[model samples]
Target: MTACIDTLDTPAAVVDVTRMQRNIQRMQAQADRLGVRLRPHVKTSKCAAVVEAQIAAGAQGITVSTLKEAQAFFQQGITDILYAVAMAPGKLTQALALRRAGCGLAIITDSVAGAKAITEFGRAQSESFEVFIEIDSDHHRSGVRSDDPVLVEIARILHTGGAVLKGVMTHAGESYSLNTLEALQAIAELERSECVKAAEAIRAAGLPCPEVSVGSTPTALSAVRLEGVTELRAGVYVFFDLVMHNVGVCRLDELALSVLTTVIGHQAEKGWIITDSGWMAMSRDRGTQSQASDYGYGLVCNSAGELIEGLQLRSANQEHGVASFEKGQNVDIEQRFPIGTRLRVLPNHACATGAQYSAYEALDERGEARQWPRHNGW
Candidate 1:
């Protein structure tokens, strides 16, 4: 018999098919409205089914955080893959293998050393590896500053050393910390301008910089215009978690992913409901901690995925989740959430939570579910 969330084992990763499709369409529409290609970051779901849905919605290519994702997706017939992280010298062979195998796999780097390493390896193997210079648009993570001369130098290294200098890319990851629309727009613009500036700088230096990419979920959704950007890349937006909601990029109802668990026990005197899902399942992401509202590990929800206001997974152990009513709710907890009571918990970081599972129990609107496998490691 086909399984549903209710019939699945506890601590399973569940994706609401309806909500997920909505999210996919929303992001694709946003990209269309902005007149840019959407290269979705597959690192969020790391599942073939999820990535296929994104491509079906008009996404051009995919951005990946690890070469493992590149390899996995490539095996699935996805050729246009961008390895968004800085290229590690040791992984050049693996990257080369993908390219030689007909994968249009692009790699990125931010430092002179990384650039030289990629160029040297490409030259040695007679492979003009496609490369993008990482731009530090928000000073949030990896990338060279748009104004920094190193930007031009890195481009030169790739071009002169027989590598394809594809363009420049930046991720305004810090946008996650902002909740206001104004702040989000400002950072989005900053992300756009800086990344464009980098691309322009490389072109000005007589380099063929064709693509300019920038985004983060909040920034992508907030940006009013992307005048010079060629493409936008975002990950967590696929299955937004509490963090994206707190960032004002998505509504709580838009979160397509959740961890399905069961009330295994209870601490009636303390008003705590013990569950089978712990840090292992939900991940250690307390992403909403510094936001306006802290959602301990995650917010509590009924089995149907409806939010249970004022309740959160307050604490967790290796195998147990301690859920409690946010102070002063003097209700009979034992009678409310007795043993064997099934529940779903929304995650703070969808990517992290999804990593804890190898496959998702894709729950459809009709309540039927099927397994969609996802890859992990490195």
Candidate 2:
């Protein structure tokens, strides 16, 4: 553990190792207490080292948004992967390749059309592909409704076609829109119960349904209990971005990821400090929008990662970011952060910010930077 950020280049993605491990342990403990396996989503960091830390901390398997993630982690010796998104027909060949290569990869589907496609492809390949049906607990995104008649239809299509119906999975993404614990817990329970009900429905029809999965970091952490959930999945909880902060899951100090930037210049009269890090580094993701507080681009912090009072990253261009004191707030921007001064900006979205970089300068307990590789694209 070393103690210095100046040794690393500016505008680099940095991880606080201590905080990240703490976060992993916390989530693992919650999953243990709830009696469910924690399949952490690797989409948040997209870094092998970070995912290994999670696995070492008791994450059973991993939930991935794309096949690229599935492939990347599989190469890292992690075979048990769940491609959580509805599998596109075009990707069946890729999934088959992984399954053939000894990767215990599972795919998900929500529509009968998708299920039929998987069924036909599996039959042609003589493969009993493992599949999980997506459940729409909060109706936020794609999934079959818990009580939808089509739920049984899709189950039959897969089971009859020699595909193994692994069970149902749901993500309470709407839980992110909530700030209070009461609402979050309600959504968590709703997510759990609805998914279990869907699985029960499938089993009652004589189809084999073994796993019932549910998640979303807020829901996973806020859940009062996990009655029938076989596993839980969440991504951003590893880094805990501004969106999660607004959702009341983590505190500012607990955030483990940040962008190390430098002050190259300043717009004096406008009270703006021009940063070398801009939209490119921050990924043009305004996730904090519509929340109780709108952090224009991101929250500004000093060289030590502490919040700069009344200061925020108000605007950003391709290669430049403008930081200023909030309206009616007074601060000498030029004098406070002059040219050549380095600082770290806490991003509004960790997943997006982390994606902007090819590698991370993971900070040790003493604040020293260590290079850790990461994968991106698709």
Candidate 3:
């Protein structure tokens, strides 16, 4: 008998268990081959069950974008954690609380002011916080430059103020814009060299620089080597999406995360199928628009997860999505996707789409489904 997953409520987030596990193992193997420990970013799933599977597959620790993730995962008994975002002074209390509760959380800083904040807070609390210097490898986002004179200055500030210098980290966030292996590999190499250079400079300044970390799903998979990096972090690879597919890292068959939406109605004249999933269900992130291939809201597929050629979520409302053929109108749209027909839409950004739902319906090889709870918000 076919699985009852199709009977679930419309607009639910679904995970193909086999594909999810395969994705996890593929990343673990790549990290092993590169000689760097895999510290997957939990912001992708924010579910303890998912992180547990990553750990079982040989992930050394988990990375987070917010303190809430650090706390939630810590409560589930995950001790090793790296808060990848640059630390904000106002949140030091929250970080301190997690640390005092024995979370083993490491924070990051990219400026002298940020370093001073950490030092002052640690001093007031009479504890030396473990911290990493954010290095900008591709000039993508927040981070001090690899060769900037301020790199050593920030390190000296953290060291002089009683914070343990944990080394450097850089993410080739710009790699997401590249589609060629050569471009991806070049950014990966730049990510490695820049971070290593920062760590070496800090160490040459008579400081303790033990870890050199860098990653992004594209770079992590594209890197031909990881000679000086000690650890790696990549999220979204756990649940490949349209954006990653367009970036040439994963294939359509590997997109494990999708929205299980039911065909509610159709506009026959316009050849559009109205689904219950809207921006509220799939998120408003159009990350694929700027990619090599724009998937509109998402790529539509049958209930069995097979792609439906030309089907695209062309438009959406708060609680509705208009799916239509990209190139031509379906003459019998209603008959093709009759009312209550089940379908799935591969999301543009797995992280954004996953946040729209509180729990995921995980479908296993037996065609059975179960719920996996996830934490959200700040």
Candidate 4:
């Protein structure tokens, strides 16, 4: 059954469940063809229901960004989790608890201090946590350089210090800044090369480097060969947003989640329409900063899900969004959408925007809505 449009609350995050499931299947299929494990990063969808859907689609393990997310998902019975962020001293207790609960907890760290703390915590607690040496592929974020001596040193500490040295992992965060496919492919190759190099380095040091994890939806989906990548850790593909589209990762039609909002006001002369959704409803994530065409927040769509030509969210306040169309633009947005009309707004960043909501209003192909709770904080 489809969700009755008249019954949904304004400024709610909705997921097209059918499309979401298909996205999961498509990603898994791609991973299968590449002969790698699909450890979908669950940070994009903190909703357990969404994770369950991913697990049903053959996700062997899940990736998360924070300890709170790890704890929340652990309580939901998800056993294998990779906290993709660097392991800090503060997160040791939580990671320990997750390990105690039968979770095969793995964390990424690049610094010696971080590694030592993690090793000490595991030892003191009598728990063995797995570790991934985070490799810096593009130098856009935290990670050890693939060729750095520190990579082998950290792996040695983890291997000898009661923690299992799982392997290496890296993210091509810089790929988001690429303006062309060639640039993205170049970044993808670097991602693969750096990760594989780190793995080979660890193995050369006589350490067991079993999993070479790599992520970034753009690189994961486009890279023709992930030669040494044992696992892929993409998160945003489940509910693609405008940023994914702008980055050449997915098309607008492939987006599976959007903000369901209601038109509340109109300024006929100015060609502006206001909706109940704003920065709070949609997030402040302007993932289009590198796009050729900067869509302020997202492309405004009509009730039937067609893009409203020339009408884009020009500005947003906490609870309101203003859409403006160029003067004399040949779009019939007003004729179909008046006050109280409901429509969906695709998000700029699925991870940030999706995190603002308490639950996902799952929708069917026919736009039927069902409720699914989500996790938040930390």
Candidate 5:
């Protein structure tokens, strides 16, 4: 049977196809304008259809956080893949298996021990794995500091120890904390300069450093120049959530992913509209809490994917989401949203929300929904 969103089950993951395609084009255009290849991080959608659309829109390759994603996409005929996370010793066997099967799976590391492990594993397996040294551009997460002497030491380890040292890459994840253009741009420049500095240090030490990759959705959209960067990488821009909206990179209307839920009941006296979607359905991500606007669990939208202003998911239990207005606002919840009313909730974090579901009901312009399966787990 041909399915429509109106007939689908509640608490389902839904994607607005048109908006998603537009998002893909926007990010691809940003990469083009900066004169760098867009290696979109697939950790956002983790769906083949979405990745295929990204590649069709001029993305050169893909970035993944896990070898499972690498294997999944590689089986879909994508050969060029970068496992962007710092490599753990336990996962080397799976990474090697992928490379041996003809997948151009490049792994990364930020420590001397990690570098030695990769090189030793490569030598034992008679393989030269492509490797990138992760740089901690924003000091928000893992990576060697761009100025740290260990930067060159790690690079030299890979180059002289049998691994193909691809280059340097960094993610300015701290960009998520800013909302203004000035701050975003400043962090973007910082991200670019710091990553490039690390690459220069490597080359100054007489090592071959070809690629300088840097990005995060906010930084990628705000970067004014990529003078030393050969590639850009970003993940969550594809299904922008409330977090990205509050970060000022995307508008409320551009959000492509939402949770389709049903208004199962109401608390008229308390003026609350209860829904079937809870943290279990939305994955408990309160990413918008520190932003300029805090949508409790999420912002409430109509089933058609339009925000119903003044309303948000105020609280959530395991399977119950309570929707109410901002403090001081008064509205008749029962009359406005009665039993069996189908509604949508825009999440605070797209990646976390997406991880809750196994597949997406992609809604096209004509109101038809088709299933697009996504993978979960490590």
Candidate 6:
């Protein structure tokens, strides 16, 4: 086995490449069993190394949250990308450039105003584009009502304006509010029904509708059925976080990404151990608000990479983290974790935490280390 100290680094994100590949394979297998396309959301791991692995693992296409992400992946030769967010006017020129470079791009829109803006932009440009109508599954965020007349109206406009109407897309944001598997399943069913119904309405309006997209880590994993979903867009499954664990989607062992930190100080009287990792390293994502266990920031692991039993990172500031140990556990919060000691912290949200770093130190099954560069901003 490779020595653990050799892979140690302070304030860096570490990804177990072997475990990550396994997670990709497992998700692909599930998608194959369901006979649905797995278009993973690449926002979780902004590293091109991870994106290439997902593509190699049978991802039909990839989903990006921003046009900038699409541009980065496009430059890497990953065509056939879906910009899941609504296309804004400022991004029209960039989108057109991507299309000219031979990207099979599809963007989402929810209102006639947005559609008209795209139509006007397309008319001024030299290339035609594919568009998907965004449907509001639970009205928790941006999207047109699935059954709204505007759905049919927008499809007709896009088709008549020479924009290819691919289909409809919706996300069950409410699924995160679920307290049980049954509740998640119910939300998933609702998401599927809404997407399918929107597509049917567009078809009924004499438009060719070929795809129905549904996404969300919670609903995608727990949903017993994906009756009419043409593609699934999920990002968090690659690095199962504390939130996913609380929702019963994955176990802590399945998590592949974590922040590597070092103990910088300690207060023997107050019984607190301070680490160099803080909100800047772990992110401000408190996904455990609804869960019974609220790890203020994240779970702390010893230098050996094992969880410190009954210990939790109770609070974090800009650059310091305070860890609390269980009362009467007799653990040496300071003696055992002297200054310069290294530790690993599991974040509540992998995406937010991963974004804070410029690169990921990849580790193999034997703990060998390699660096993978990532992009940020915009």
Candidate 1, residues 142-218, lDDT tens digits: the string is 89999999889889999999999999999998998898999999999999999998888988989999999998888
lDDT score, candidate 2, position 336: 78
Candidate 4 C-alpha lDDT tens digits along 1-378:
445546788888888787789889989988888889999999899889999989988998899988888888888888889999898888788788778778888888999988899888888888778989899999998999988999899999999999988889999998877756788778888999999998999899899999999978888787777787899989999998888887887878788888888999887667778899899998988878667778887887765566766768878899999887866785555775689988788888989888889898887766577888777888
Model 2 misplacement above 4 A? 1-4
Model 1 ranges off by over 4 Å: none
Candidate 4 — which residues are off by over 4 angstroms? 1-3, 330-336
lDDT of prediction 4 = 0.85
lDDT tens readout by residue for model 2, 181-249: 999999999999999999999999999899999999999999989998999999998989888899999
Better candidate number, 3 or 6, judged by TM-score: 3
**Tens-digit per-residue lDDT, 1-378, candidate 3:** 434576777888999989999999999999999989999998999998899999999999889998989999999999899999899999999999988999899999999999999999899999899999999988888999988999999999999999999989989899999999999999999999999999999999998999998999999999999998999999999999999999999999999998999998998877889999899999999998897788899999999899998898988899999999965544578878999999899999999999998998888988787888998988
Q: What is the C-alpha RMSD of each candidate to the true structure, in Å?
A: 0.8, 1.4, 1.4, 1.7, 0.9, 1.7
Mark the regions of model 3 whose C-alpha exceeds 4 Å error after superposition: 1-3, 329-331
Q: Looking at model 1, which ten-residue stretch has the lowest summed lDDT?
A: 325-334
Query: What TM-score would you give candidate 1 relative to the actual structure?
Result: 0.99
Kindly give the stretch of ten consecutive residues in candidate 2 with the minimal lDDT sum.
1-10
**Candidate 3 vs. true structure, TM-score:** 0.98
Indicate the worst ten consecutive residues by lDDT in candidate 5. Answer: 326-335
Candidate 1, residue 100: how far the Cα is off, in Å? 0.8
Count of clashes, each model: 0, 3, 0, 3, 0, 0
Cα shift from native, residue 257, model 1 (Å): 0.7
TM-scores for the candidates: 0.99, 0.98, 0.98, 0.95, 0.99, 0.96
Judging by lDDT against the true structure, name the best candidate: 5
Q: Which scores higher on TM-score, 4 or 6?
A: 6
